[model samples]
Structures are given as structure tokens and as C-alpha cells.
Target: MKKKLLASLITAMMSPVIYAQPLPPVEVIGTPDEINQQRLSKETVQSNVSATSDVVEILTESPSVSVNQAGSISGFPVIRGLADVRLDVQLNGMPLLSSCPNHMNTPLSYVSPSQVDSIEVYPSITPVSVGGDSIGGSILVKSDKPFFAPTAEQVTQGEIGAYYRSNGNAKGGNVEVTTANDKISLTYKGNMAQSENMDAASDFKTFTTTTNASSGTYFTSGTEGTTTDKDEIAGTAYESINHSLGIAYKGDDSLFQATFSKQSAPYEQYPNQRMDMTDNDSNKLNLSFDKSMNWGKFNIQAYAEQVDHEMAFMDYKTSKQMPMDTESETKGLKASALIPLSASSELTVGTEIQLFKLDDYWVASPAPLPHMMQPNTFWNINNGTRDRYALFAEWEKELNPQWKTRLGARYEMVNMDADDVHGYNLDYFPTSGSGGAGNQTTDAVAFNNAKHAKTDHNLNLTALANYKDSDTFDIEMGLARQVRSPDLYERYTWSTWPMAAIMNNVVGDGNGYVGDINLNPETAYTVSANFDWHAANQKDWGLQVMPYFTHIEDYIDAVVERDFNDDFKVLRYANQSARIYGVDIAANRKLAENNYGDWSMKAKVNYARGTNLETDDNLYNVMPLNATITLMQAINRWSNAVELILVKEKDEVSEVRNEVKTPAYSLVNVRTSYSWNKLRIDLGVDNLFNHAYDLPTGGAYTGEGNTMSINGIPLMAVPGAGRSVYLGFNMKF
Candidate 1:
């Protein structure tokens, strides 16, 4: 089917040129305000395309950005000390949601690194115009845009790339093609990647089989057969493919564009969580129109998305595989206008509306003798819906030659509701007791009897100022008030049973979670400052330091609901006060320039801490102090670089969740790339020392064994990958 679709697209090109010259790169023009935010360099983005499949990894080079490792393709982005739903993440200016309960399919997972054209991060002091329904900062990602020929003559251009990695024997390839005239263009992109289970730098487990030690029972690992080796990370393997088609039209004063995309993944294993993703398929359509008016600029955008997701025991967790399925739909529309109020000032206003619906259910397990195995279907989240409507306005003014200021405000109305839910049975299988079945029935009764509808009126405000102190120094400060409403799962999940609760966890912690309908929206007040020091020429050396603090009211935190006296526990979401503070430093300098090449050095450091003010317990999954430094040499069309990564020991942890602690560690990596007129080749080696270390934010490892039982697995943090050598090549026509 994939091949047939690509062939059809190619045939529809109307016999265009097959190997025409590559078109000149497009130049982006933005307002001066855009320069205030930090952006990733194009070189840096292109260089890492062959090293990782996750687009979120590219943002780690920016200050105050971290990743909560999950599946290879679905790493959660963390800003400051918060992650997941707390951050407002956008792809191609559209906000997307993870349809799965475990978040196996994230927004970034849909777009490959090779498709990214530009990325920007607003670590803390986010502008109100760009922030909505989120307390943390914002991340913006844009895909490569369609290109049109400069002349009336038709033009055809494309690029094909392939890569291979030694670790896990990973391999993938990508292809992109564009055909265009002066006024219209059509483009297509497709990519697929797959890998075997990766191994840790050293053996971390004692046993090879995942069979339950206490019960002396074993099950096959999916259809693949057998158990994992001592050094293998059982559930780290994955396979995925993505395809997109775009069309664009340019008029004298207006432009219209549309994109259709699809994604399919047979499996994406998650070692940190108990369950693995068996299938995830999605389809999306996006449309936009932009016009240049005499008074201002006007734009409108509309998008729709649908996802079908399934989860079950895969890889090593093979005992009594339970099938869970989810279906979600999203639709959104936005319109904005930028008007110049004066020569030195501009007014920007926009309004947006989004509607989402979801349904999650689990089928009855195969007839079995196990006490917990049921004979009926389970309703997890039936007919769930969340809708948001928002309006925002911002004003930017050049107060004077040396200072500029911006003020903005936004209002959002969020409504959420879900139908009743129930478990597979009302009583224990063999005997009637106060166990899993009884608790499930009781929780279902209570949830059904109570109201499931909720509404929140949220407001956000921002005030910012920038001062150009001198030719070599400048400073910027800002204050912001942000608000975020809970997601459907946080407000509608209706079960306390350990097994059911564990399935709803999105943080990858080896724990179960229950939701509360009474939970309140989070409101935060933040203050931040940035100091920039640079050489007079702004090329030889540069340094940027940012510090920020936030106080949050009604923060969504968990409280122990059921303690099993073990590593895993069941918790209920509740509203509480919390605080977070962090600092980020980034610097770069020209080390030397000789016949060898122009040498340069760059470094980034980040440190953040979060505390539950009510209980004084540390926040879960807060990254430890870390830094990355790189040395680069460039000569002609050849580029080479070496990187060092350092991380501190994690001692502060969430007492309620029994979060694991990791020891300090460091690693080295090297890469070199050479380019010809129309082709490029890259070679790189990661974890050059093959060092053994635990990932501070990797959560608990439950890749295999009796994952169904809450306490069946041992307590341990996931280990980092071993050394890997990769080779890649790309050709353009």
C-alpha cells in the first residue's frame, strides 16, 4: 500500500523534470520581536538528523530544555522542571494531543527530524500571544515549506537520504520530492525506521528470563519467541513510517496552502511502562490562507486529525496479554490579524477554537484460570470530550532607541465531560472478596453517580521589557501569569483498581494513577530575566544567562490512595500549591583559526528544582543539573565536532511516588560530515567510551516479566544505550 501511494503521487506529477538543479533556499522575514526568542541553528538541526529519530531531541541544545525518555520516537519535552501537558507545544503552528493513555504517540513523534525546517523555544518568559491553556513555556516547530520556481519555467527537485546504526542494527531512509511552477507547487515526503531491542552498556539485570520469580510462570515474548538477554533492554525496539503531501498556491497578494499526512506504527515498545504499543495509526489535514492588506496582515488556519491506537503485551511482557484500544478526533480553527498602530508600535490579535473527542476500551481477555483474568469487556474512557475557545491581544512598542516593551492578555474557556465507565467484572473470579473486582465496582458506582462535566475560565497576562545597554551587553526582563486546565484523563479516568490505574499513567513512573473530577485548573505567576554579553562584532564570543521562578496555585499533584508497601503505588490527582526555580547558561567562543580549520567551542548548562509547597515533597521527574559542551572545526565543505555530556547525581525525589535516584555520569561523542556539490556523507559514533549509567529521567524499568501484577517487577532505573556507530548519505537533484 505504501509503495502504491508513492507511485500514484509520482505519476500525477505530469511528466516533470526528474533531475533538475536544486532550487535556491528560501529567505524567511520576521519582525524584530522574533529575534528575542532563542532559535536552533539550521546547521545544528541538519547535523543531528542521522543520529536520532525523535524531533524533540533537537531542542535539547537550547537552554532549559530536557527530555523525559519514553519510547524511541516519543520522548516528552520538559521545560524548567515541568513536562508533558504542562508545556504548550506546537507543530506547524497547530497544537496536537497524544491520543493514547500512556502517551505512546506524541506530537513530535509524527514529524521526523529530517522534516524540520525551524525550531524555537521560549523557556520561561513566554509571550501571551504565543501562550494559551498552558503554564510552562512554549515550543514551536515548523516543517520544511513548499518551494516554487523563481521563473515561469517548471522545475522539479528532491532529496533522498539513508542511514544505518550499529547499535540494535537500526536502519531507515527518507525521500522528498517537489514539483512547481512560478505560481503553484506540490510536494511529498515519506520515511520509515525500525530497530531491534538495544542493549545497555553493561549487564544490569541478574536473570535472563522475564518469568515471574514468585509464581514460577512464564509466557512467550509476543510472537518473537523466548526471553531477553541479561544486557538487553527488552522493550526498546520500535518500527514506524510517516508520509505527507502538500500543495500551495501563490497569488499577487494572497497565498493558500494545504497538507495531508498519515502515520502508522506496528509497535513502539516502552521499557519504562508496563504495557507496550501494538499499533498506532493517524491521519491529519491542515489548511491555511494568508493575505497582505494595506492596513495589516491577515491569516486563517484550520486543521483536523484522527487517531486509532492499540496497546498490549509485546516484547518481553508476554503473560496474559490484554488488548486495549483508543480512538480520538481533533478539530481546530484560528484567525489572526497584525495591524501597525503607529510607526513604532503594532497591535496583534487572534482567536482560536478547538474540539476534541476520545473513546478508550479494553476487550475481554481469552478464557483463563487466573483469578484476575476477566470474561467481560472494560470501559476505560467512554465518550470523552474536551473543548477550548480562546481570544488574545498583544501590543509591542518601541518606547525609545534603547528600550522596547510588550504587553499582552489572553482569555480561554475550557469545558470537559465524559460518560460513565466500568470494569470487566463485579466480583473476584474464583471467590467473592474485597479485592480488585470489588474496588472496581465501587469506584465505578461512585463515578457514575456523580457529575462528570467540568468547566474552567482561564486568563493569562504578560509584560516584558528589553534594554540595549551597550554595544557589548543587553538585558531583558518579563513577568507572566499563565493558566492550564486538566486533560481528559486527569479529570475523567474513573477507576482505583491497581491494574486499571497503571494503564492510565503518562509519566512512565512504575505507578498507577486515579483521577478526580473536582480537580481545579493550575494558575501560575512567573518572573524571569535574561542577560546577554557578546563581542562588539557579535561573532567571536557570546554568553547568555537566564534565571526564572514560578509560583503555582492549584497545581495538579498526586496523593497516595493505596499503598502496597512496595516500589509501585496507586495515587489520586489533587490540587495543591507548588514552586519551581531554575537557571540556564549558554556560551560560545572562537578557540582558534589555522590551516587545520576554524575551531570553535560552545556549551550549555541547566539546573532546576521543584517543590510541592503544601507537603514539601520534591516534584517527580525533575532533571538533575546537566551540561553539554562541543568543539567544532569547519574547513570548506567539511565539518567535524566532538561533544561531552555531563550529568549530576539525582538525590531529591518525590516521596509519594518512590522515585528512583541515579548516579552521576559522563559520555563522549564524535561526528564528521563532508559535502560535495549535490551530495553529503556523515559518520558518527555515540557513547564512545561505552560507559554504564542510569538515565535520571528514564523513570522505573518494567520492560518485561509479570508486568500485569503491580509489584511483580523489580525496582530499577532504565540504563543508557551502549556505543553505536552510524553512517548516513544524502543526495539532492
Candidate 2:
């Protein structure tokens, strides 16, 4: 199977060369950085931004990136089939931690697409200059910088934009104002957005309750259900607002900047989980300094952020509301310097320290008979902390005119600790030992008496070589060894029951999960290569092919424990060996130009597979093979495009978790934009054909108030959004 896939990839890469024709103008989406860095294009960023946009939406345009969506707004990016803590995501060069135990409020959820200037991506292999605590990949989101006037005279500049969409009745607006001079600059930005429940296609399938005597006639039985079409997706409404202020000072040889931001989200519902976000707020402050000297360049930065989050069961689901509160605080410092070693060589050295603290607890509400377990507050995690310190060095040199190489290394130390935690005892429930409030059990007592303190030491190394064989072709090869320590939630969640155990899950799998304190850090060794082919001018046509393989030691895997009952199995986090391999292909060509406009075509294909060597089972939630094609036309100030997306059926699923299979589907969309004077207008229709389909990586279905079985087996995935028309307007001063 692997050989056949490789052969098909090679055939696809060479097809474009054999059918060469008159090329059209090509828009470069990535700018080459030192060794393994790539910058997103302005056109690509603008095309994907909208009122209800997140960073994951824009990142999915890249060849090697995909997204796992649990709701309309809860989307997480997956790099080479790795996500969550395995990947490092930074906003304006600072790390942001999610306060929700379920990770409904991810780091990227805080930044709106309009506020982002550009994004730098490192796929599979990362540099030492960036932080070295992740094993998957790295993403850096940069905001618009303060502008300085050419002369001493002060200048004022700003922009305002608004957009509306029909699917969810979504509407939002953003505004920014800046006044600057050569010596000083000041800027302020604000945005607000709101949306209702999203509508799915007519044929979207969802599990509904039906009568069946053969399955023992139980409401929670998974074998007594059938699939049916649903129109509106439940528990998917959201509202958010954000504000930021910036100030900068520029001297002859030095520059200093400070920024402060605040975000408030009143509510965001998650359709793929049992709970919804009721309230979330965050505050951030950052300070940075840069100076130029005769020896080299120097940079210093410090940042801090705090988040407060609350979650509760939706009103339609249950009469009693169970509330969960969580808090997270993070502080970081980074300093780096570049020194010239020779005419063709430069060295970079840096150090970074990050401290994270978390507090999680829950309050149970009064309920009627059978379900009335406890009304006291439970301590999920008390004073949990994780600290990381790292030092790194990198060297980049031009060996000759056509050959270049980069070597880097990093050393990291991780320290984790937490106070004793407590939860509701099994004896407090009706099904267990005794139906009492204060009764204690062996499992709860053992967890409370357990000691939780651990430390890990890790080292990362990278080597990359690039050969500029000719003006139109380049070859790049890289090898990397990366390491990542277990997160606090994966090591300190102190519950073995269904309710408490399932609440700590971040993958939206709708299954209960318990943490194991003995998990070891994961280490990954990867080798990758990239081949780029372009026109002689490198502006008319282009094609890029990347292939990679990774082997991981002590990889995190979930084990099923069926000791509790037959209705559900408890999943415990454990360590094992795993392997992942994939290939990415992209091609673009400017076909021709006529009286109507200039025409062009672009296509992208992505494939990935992962397996655990210990259990010989497929990895959970792996994305299937997918492809996209776009046809574009450009006039003087107007541009139009149509897109076709295709996804293959996914059958290689995880047997341990009883993962579901998604059928193949295709979709079509059209969009157009026009700019006049200082204003621009955009109009588009998504899902033009109104095809009903389910996302392969959408996770399990947990729709509220729906007549679906609540059993945690034979998983039912959430359906994708239906047809929608949108209009947007933007103006500049």
C-alpha cells in the first residue's frame, strides 16, 4: 500500500511538466526564510478572512495542514496528523494557554483574522530560534505593526470593515485607528461579532432514537438507533468582543514597543461535546525591545496573560445546570542575539523561560431522585503548575555558490507539580456503594494520597541542506529530532468515574478519559524532503512536492478500561511507539489572458496515515486523503474564483475507540470581489451545490436536545455546514 501511494504521488508531480502550456501570472503564497520557514501570502490571507473566522480556517490552505472542527467556531489545526499540545502555537511571539479543560477556547481562538498581518509556518521540522517544546510543528501569528511617518510630521491612518452571512445570521464589524510620527506611534483596534445556530444541508445525517426490543429496550443503548436528516445544528451559537492598544518609540538605533489587549466572549456552544462555554475572558500585556549594533542585532521580549473560563450544560439539555470554572496564567521571557561569524556565516543564540499555572474546579447543582449525587464543590486540580526553560543555538552558512546548510540544537527542562486533588466518591451515587454525600471510597482515597511531582530533560537537533540546482528548480532535505513533555491535564486529572473523567478530554471524542501520572515524554525523529519546480522567471507557474516520515518513542495512546460497566469504557492515557508518514503536492499555472480577464488554475492534494506499533491499530481522528482545485480570473480591480473540494472515504479507523467511518463527498463554491477608490466589496456563496456531507475529522456527535443515544460507542460524527451567502465591505482612510 505504501509503495502504491508513493508511485501515485510521483505520477501526479510529473503530470504538470508533461502538459506545459502558456503560463499565467502566479501569486507566491510562501516566502522562503533561512532554512525551513515559509510566510503566508497577503492574497491568501484576505480570501479566507470573514466575520466568523479563526486561524485554523486560513491555515487549512497550506498543503500539509488540516483542521478538526467540533462546531461552527471550534476548529483546531492538525499538522502532519498531530495536534493540541504536540504543536506549538504562538500569537505575536508569545504563548497562550487554553483555560478550558476540554480546550474549547484554544489559543488561536483569541485572535481574529482581520488583526493578523501574516503567519509563518514550519512543517514537521522547526528551528532552534523558535521555542523547542513541541514535537509536531510550529505556527507564528503576527499582528499589524505600528506605522511611522516618513518625516517628523504626524500622520493619521485607519480602516473599518463589516460583514454579514446568511447561514447563521452572523454579523460583525471591526475598526482600527493610528496616529504616528517618526519618533512615536499610537494605535487602537476593536471588534465584535455574534452568530446564531448554524444550518446544515438537507441530507445531513444524525442518529435518532427508535424502538428496538432486541437491544434490551434501553434509552442509552447504542444498538437501538437509526440515522436521519437534520436541518439545524444545535448548540452552536456564539458572541465575542476584543480590544487592543499599542504604543511604540523609535530612536536613532533602537526601538521599543508595548501592547495590551482584552477579550470577552459571553457564550460559545459546542455541538461535539456535552458541555458549552458560558463565559470566557482574557487579558494580555507584552513588551519588546530591539537594537542594532556594529557587532550584530539584539532582541528582548517579556509577556504575560491570564484567562478565566466558565462552562455549563445547555438549557435545552437538562433542567439542572452543572457549572465548571477554570483559570490559567502564563508568563514568559525571551532574549536572542545574532553574531556574524564570517562573510557567509551567521550564528544565533537565544534563551526562553515559560511558567504556567492552572486552577480547575466544579460545582454540582441540586437535582431530582436517581441523578442526585452531590451538591458540593469538587477540586479537579489545585495549584497545578508547569515550568519550562530552554537554551538554543543555530548556525547558517553558505558552503558554496549553489549549496547552503543550517545546523541547530536546543536543550529544554520541564518541571511539573500539583497539590492533592479530590472528586466525588463512587459511594455518593445511587449505583455505587452507598447513596450518601460524604461517603469515601478506595479509588478516591488512593488518588488523594498520590504524590505528583515530575521532571524531564529533553534535547532537540536539526540539520537542513538546500541545493539551488538551477533557476527554476531547487531541492531541500532535512532531518530533525524533537521532544515534548506531557501536559498537566494528561498527567494530573484525578478521577476514574465517567462524568469527571470525560470532562477532561480535549479531543471531543465523546468518551471518558483518565490521566496517568507515569507517562513519559514523547520524542520524534523525522526525515523530509521538498522538490520545487517553477518557470524560468519563477512568476508564471510553480509546483512543490513534499514527502515526510516520522517515528515517535513513548507516543501518547489511549487504552480502554471496561471495569466500570458494559455501557461505556473508560479511556486512560498511556505511552507507546507510533509511526506516521505523508505526502503533500501543489501545482499552479496561469493558463491564458483574454478580454474578460486573466485566467489561472491551482490544485492541492494532501494524504496522511498513522499507526501504533505496539497495538498495530490505526491512530484516532486521522484525516483522510483530500484534494482541492481553484480556478481564478482577474480583471483590473475585480477578481473572481470558483473552488471544488473532494474528500475520500475513511475506513481505516481505530478499533480500540470504535471510531466511525465517513463517506466520500464533494462541494463547490464561488466568490467575487471588487475594489474602487478606498473601498472594497466582497460577495460569495459557499456550498453552491448544497451538498450534504460530514467532515471526516469533525469528531463525535453530541448534539443537545436531539433524540440521539448517549452511549459512547459506534460514534456518530457531526455534519458540515450548508449553503450560505455572504457580503462584506471595507474602507480605508
Candidate 3:
């Protein structure tokens, strides 16, 4: 499909050199903004493509939500007012389950922009088929179906394309090949690169020549400076590795996809207590299928993934080794169906089941034996897992031309089990820790004694109403009740590592611990409404605007509290109330008539603000108001484009003190492409202007009061990359 799109983009670039005309405003397809509105395709509620991309560069740059990417490792997407599972993510109709204790992966880690067909972000609840777990609403993501790549017709057979982007020594490439016939077709696409990121500006009193001022922990950027150890706050530059490959198959009745990826990076992150997450390796395998027939359109998918991570950062004023090594895996399946009864009605139903697992194979060699439970010795190992299943359905009907109503319900079940399989309990080993080594004590390869399990049930009900095509505006409203259970981390594991604490890597505290056994699933009451306006449309010009809101009950998240030991700390999962709301507005204009190689301009601005409602605290990682403008030029076999992007500052923060303060900024980027026969080439400069910035603080445990390393190095402000560029090429036979 990317091949087809590239081809079409090429044809649009070539074919008669007529200047490109601006396109009409596009309606969102999946967002559940107002009551009874049917938003699909050109109308998918307000889709948020950012859900499947990296936080630093994904789509949600609203004014209300603030998002900060922690180095290249993990990303936190601050929604209108929620984070974690409170904001559900549905990928290709299936949930992209996030099962990490630290939320290393959110919905954003899955696919890139090229693989997306639409993004549906219901900043507010609007339907039941989309689920009811959202206190911060939801995002429904769809990938391009395996269809022949599209290209303007000169009459066609196939097409090919390539592109390059770079800044400094930084560079990358993208290539796509596609072909299709009336019955069978396929699209193959991939991107690969090696580049250096720019150092991040510091969080001190000065950042750049034109920096900002800080009062307490609050930072307002306007007049910026580059001072303090501010420069030290920058993430490593030139640390690199990124690549991905995908294939889509299309038949008269179905679509199938297979994909794989590998990525790596070395850098320090911000708002974190530890120094780094390095020697990191990640592997992913995914497969999915979709089919439509007389009965209905159905979809199902299965995927497995692993992250081989290593990090030797400063903690407790000491250096805990890297790859203290931890690995995580997820395997699961999901299926859904949509059946049409009449032109005015449809019924949608689906079920999904998946198993999530985690294992921490400590890299400490000499592996532990039965009698070696001495204080600092390598003792045991552990493996943990969680399983989940959900069934849901919804029915919709048009009561009249201007009014639509719908009803839906869902049921979910969960089961979890975890234990420390191999570890000795010599004189000092806790049952939860890896066991001992040598003499008189017991020794084992995989101990299976310490274990635990739990089962859960949840149900949700929904109602929706939409009033469409009324004057020049539209409205949609919806309400839903949803329940969710605690995952693996929320239930098992409670071992301390000499590796926790910023100044105590050599000291001691349980680094990766688990919460108590008695915990309740989170439940929410989500109500949402949307108001949309097509304020204007003239020859080659159009405008669109939308806004919405949502509320949640018993929100689930980990909180900090003193532990049994007077000098220690541990995290526990608890239920809290939360409410979130936000809005999106966009517009487009034809730069010229479709004649003379059509040329045009496009731009969008979005914003969202979320609150815990209970404490009225900001959810971690929410995005802030943002806007983008791009100039597109369409010509004969040749075309190019340029863009300007802007993101504002974020102030709302979680209750945790010393919380990182984020600053706002802007950027510039450009791209161009050319086509000859079935071959094409292109180039792009992301962060074209190369602005330096830091994401929201990603928390790393710091013992009571310390931030220095074993080498006496004060923790640096971990920020993402600065400027980057890429160069890529490709062709079809």
C-alpha cells in the first residue's frame, strides 16, 4: 500500500506538470467526539496517528496534552488527562497490549506513519465498539490494507520509490515497492538508518543563547541560554540504529501482513535517576489477517516480541552494571467482526485473547549455587506472566436522516501467574530473590517454588447518539462504563537489587519490585461529546474544527510510598479517579488550480488537556498544543514539499515532587521526490532546523536524597536527539 501511495504521490508529482491544487478538508474516521456521529474513513473520529509512533515525533501535539520522549528508549503520551492503560490503544482493530512494569512500550511503538491508513482519537467516549476503558478516551489505529500502491493514472501497471533525509552526520533512508492486479496484489516497504542525534539542551537556568528562566522547578522558555551543566543534560549525540520491514498481501477476499524490526541506541535520558539504558536490542514478529464477505468483515492477528536490554548507569552514587539484563515477551491474538443488516444499520462484534510474559535472567556470572547467598553474590533468576481475554459487541441504526443512535456492551476476563524459578535461599537469600551457590545450601537451574496467581472479570455498557449535517455544524455524544484488571507487574515480584538508587548502585534497595497481592482492577464511567464545524469551503479551500471530553473512575497506576524498611521505597498499583478533555482543529488550502502541475499547502493544529480529576494533577506525558504547516508542489515527474512545525510548553505535572519541568519549541523540515518510469528517489530533513529539547521526566528510582554517580558525576538531564537527516533509494523491475 505504501508502494501504491508512493506511486500515486509520484504520479501526482509527475504526470502533467500542472501545479497541485489544495485538497478539500478531510473528515476524521474513528474519533468518538460528539454523541451519535458515524466517523469512519474520511470520518474516523479524530484519529491520532501518534498512538503507533514514537512520542518525540508522533502526531498528538495538542495544546492541552504534553508528551516527552525519554531518550529513544521509552515514551509517555500524556493524554487530555490520563496515561497508562486509562487511555486504551486499539491497533488494526486489536489492542497493542502494553505489559511492562515501567510501561517501556505504549501503543506508539508499533507501526510508522507509512503503514497507517487512519488515526481515530476520541478525546471523549463516543461509542461502545471502541471500548469503554478510556478515562482519557481512546485511539483506534488502522494500517493500510494490502492493496496495490496507488498512483495517479497515466493508465498503470506498477511503480517504485525512494527518499533521503539528513542533518549533520545523521542520515537514513526509505524505499517501497508495490504491484497489484484485479485479484492479487502486494506491497513491500522498509526503512533503515544509522545516525547521530544532537545533544539536548540542559534544564538549568540557561539552555541556549536565547534560553529561558527557572523559578523553583517551573521553566518558561522565551529568552533561552546555554549554561549551567545544562550542556551535560544533552543525550549522547551520534548514538544510533533504526530499521523496519513489512509485507502486505491482498486477495479478492482478504488482507494479510508480516513484519519484523530491529533497533538500538546509546544515550542518557532526562527526569530519570539512573544514567542510561544501553546495549539495548529489540526484536519483533507480527502477523495479521482481515477478510470481508456476505456475512461481515472480520479480522485477526498474532504477534510475539522481545527486548534484550542492557544498562550500566549511575545509581546511588555507584555504577550498576548494564544488561543487569532483563527481557520481556508478549504473545497474543485478537479477532473482530462487523455485519451489515440494512443500508441504515450495522452490528459490530469481536473477541481478543493474549498472554504477556516477563523474565529477568540476571547477567551476574558464576550463576548462583545453593550455598552462596552471601550479601552481594549472584543468587537466582525469575520469570513472570499474565493472560487476558475480551469479548464485545455493538449495534447501530439510523432513526432518521439527521439522527443516529447506537448501543453496545463488552466483557473481559484476566488471569495472571508469576514466580522466581531459580535461586537459592542460603543464609541471606529471600524466597523472591535468585538463590545461593556452593557448599551445604541448595542449588538449582530453574527453581519453581515462589509463585502466585489471580483471576479477574470486567464488563462495560455503552450508549451513543449523533446529529449530523445540521446547518454547518455536527454533534455527537456518548456514555460508557468500563472495568480493567491489574497486570503482571501490579501483582508479583518483590526483589531488591544492589542496582537501584542513583547514588547507591553499590548500596542496596530492591530495584524492580512488585506490589501486594490484594489489588482491584480499575473501573471508569466515560462520557463524551463532540462539536464539529466546516466553517468554510471555497474553490480549492476548506476548514475543519472539533472538540471533546472524557471521565474515568478507579484509574490504575503505580504510586510511591515508604516500604517496610525505614530507609527504603517501593511502588504499588492503586485505583484513583481521573477526568480528561481536549479538542482538535485543522484546515487545508489549494495553492493553485489542479492545472499547471497542482501545488498546494496543508496544516493542522491540535490540543488536549487531561487531569486526574481526583487530585486534579496532570497525567504524566500528556502532549501540549501543537501545529504544523506544509507546502506541497505537484509537477510532471517531479515534486517537492517543505514543512514548519511548532510545539508549546507543558506545566501540569504529576504530584511527585522534583517532577521535571518541560519547555516548548518549534522546528522546520523539508522533502522532495522524483520519478522516472517505475523508479523514484526522494529526500527529507526531519527537525530540519535542528532545535534541541527535552521530553517529560521519565522516573528512575533515586534513594531518599542523592543524584550523583559512582564517579561523582551528577545526573545529566536526559533529552532526545537534536537534528537528523536521511538518504534512501529504490525501484521496481
Q: Assess each prediction's global lDDT (C-alpha) against the native.
A: 0.84, 0.77, 0.50
Output the number of the TM-score-best candidate. 1
Q: Residues 1-733, candidate 2, lDDT per residue (tens digit)?
A: 9999989755643343322223224565444445666567655676565534667888877877889885455588888899878888899999666777789888888887777888877888888788788888888888887799887598999989989989889888889899999889999988887887677887454444442433322222111233222566655678889899999999899899999999999888776777778888999999999999899999999999999999874442333456789998999999999999999999999999999999998765555412423545666777899999999999999999788999999999999988765554332322223222323243445555666788999999999888889989888888999999998888887666665666777887777677777889999999988898888776679898989999999999899854444434568899999999999887889888665567798888999999999999999888899999999976656667899999999898887766668999999989887666777788899899888888788777665432122364344777788898889887889
lDDT ranking, high to low: 1, 2, 3
Clashing pairs in 2: 24-590
What lDDT is reached at residue 691 by model 2? 88
Ranking by TM-score: 1, 2, 3
Go through the candidates in order and give the clash count of each. 0, 1, 121
Give per-residue CA lDDT, model 1, range 414-449, as digits (tens).
999988777787422222233356386677777877
What lDDT tens digits, residue by residue, belong to model 3 across residues 608-710? 6667766667765555677888777656655566778777775775543224456787878776555565455555666666577654344322211122222
Off by over 4 Å in 1: 1-32, 210-223, 316-320, 369-373, 426-438
Mind sharing the TM-score for model 2? 0.90
Better of 1 and 2 by lDDT: 1
The C-alpha stretches of model 2 lying farther than 4 A from their native spots are 1-25, 203-229, 316-319, 367-373, 425-440, 563-568, 705-714
Question: Measured by TM-score, how close is model 1 to the native structure?
Answer: 0.93
C-alpha root-mean-square deviation, each candidate = 7.2, 8.4, 9.4
User: Least lDDT summed over 10 consecutive residues: which range in candidate 3?
Assistant: 214-223
